[model samples]
Target: MNIHEHIEKWQVEDGVHLFDKIKLPDNSVLIDFGCGYGEYTISLALSKKHSTVFSVDKDERMLKIVQDKIESHSITNVRLIKADGTLSIAFPDCYSDMILMYDFIHGNTQEKLPIRFKFFEEARRVLKPNGILSIAPFECEYLRDSSGKRRRYSLGMLISEIESYGFRYSESIDGAVHFDYYHSPYHWKKLNGEMSFDYLEIGPVMNFYKQK
Candidate 1:
């Protein structure tokens, strides 16, 4: 299958529609953390025609995938950064309008939570006022292995940790929830107490946590 089809399969397998949750402002500068290949990144770049996008991933193999894409499509608006997920990203203060962590935290083990939180803290620092942020948590951020299929997290830890970084709050997408994530409205509600949001709840939707 092609990338779109693959992402769809991933959506079904993981029960999340990452692409749909995000709401981009015109000319926004967006970043896709942990962007694997260039599927969603390219889609975001193409969709947000006037915006600049940064596709960040530590895996060098995927760089070629993304490079092939940006080159083939002749798209100049994306910047690819190679760095460790938990390390502080090198960007100026308040530099981004949107940041996406697609299955980023989940990949790190418990030992890395500090680093993960640091990334979030740094992300919050660099985010512009009212900037958007999205994360796709595939179960516990600490439990790396095959357990995600069995051990589901409360999302409370994830939410609290993220909120502690100083993001204000926003609503969630709640209609037809993504079929892949296995998380319900209750999960989102639990994650963001008293925070409200708009939900596409459908395939390819984005789940946004705006900068306070």
Candidate 2:
């Protein structure tokens, strides 16, 4: 299936099931950072109708797509924000219950670590005490360190990095599907008619809680 078909299926069927594993509390304030194409954002909005979801992205086109989806589904609880790439969130302190960072953190290069840390600080600032920070670090297997050396990325490394930013490793949900377009390698094979598969790319969703 094409991207649109996959998105439609995800919003109506698969995405909701995927999000259920995270066990987000109803009526909470949530943020989907770097909400590309808004697949997860739409799914989140649909699944937790009472929750207020903020879909933040630097790209206007992606936000437009999310807006269209919200209008089509008559979802009123989702707000879209165009990020300015300053590693800053527009909300006040202790305003959100959760922040979703699915498929956003990648590369892991030395130069980018400071930016990531800054964003983590922003996340900590916006989340209420003990709030959730869910992350799915897809495509982060290989990374370069500060000395231009290659390093392998692992769950432990991720946990350590997050812990340094005042978040405690809470839990992780395995077998979570990555819904982004380029992240699913099998989709390309299907597009080229090389092979057929019924499954999407699977990864783990790591959840962390803010420390008071």
Candidate 3:
């Protein structure tokens, strides 16, 4: 599918429902961390006219694509940033209403944990009190530690890791496609079938909140 088709599916077909399920505030300041091609960034910008959205990525090329989209649509509420690293996020403490970490947590090697850890710490610092921290680590793979051993991080483990950085686990939302980057039979079952489950170990997006 072309970018236009993908954007349509995201806005009209699936992505809107996903953000809706998460109860994204209509007038919040959102930072799309590691935003690739501005899928969630653009959707959230259009999701509410009063809200401000920042699309952040390490790749200039990806940011350019999002810039093109924003300009073509005349979306003034969205901003683009080329990430040098998490330390370069540039937002002041408690500045944003939410930080989005979607499809971006893979490739965490032992040597990379400190950097990723700093990223999470930055996420915590930038969010306002009671601000949301939304994460959907779609690549549910084993994470490597300093010793080079791989550890299979379950949903609980993932939550624990995030909470270790001073955030509180809130809730998880199911049945919404994660920007077409993630899908699971678990969500499909709950959406189409009679299966009634409060939470799935391997599906949906996880949510957290900054307590302080």
Best by TM-score: 2
Predictions ranked by lDDT, top down?
2, 3, 1
Q: Candidate 2, which segments miss by more than 4 Å at Cα?
A: 1-6, 107-114, 144-150, 182-199
| Candidate 2 global CA lDDT score | 0.79
Per-residue error for 126 in candidate 2, Å, reads: 1.0
| Model 3: per-residue Cα lDDT over 132-210, one tens digit each | 8888767656775435556787888888888888899998876433443223466666566433223323357778999
TM-score of each: 0.66, 0.84, 0.77
* Candidate 3 off by > 4 Å: 1-7, 24-26, 86-88, 108-114, 146-148, 175-203
Whichever of 1 and 2 has more lDDT, that candidate is: 2
Clashes of each: 21, 0, 0
Q: All models: lDDT?
A: 0.61, 0.79, 0.72
How many collisions between residues are there in candidate 2?
0
lDDT of 3 at 103: 68
Question: Lowest lDDT 10-mer window, candidate 1?
Answer: 195-204
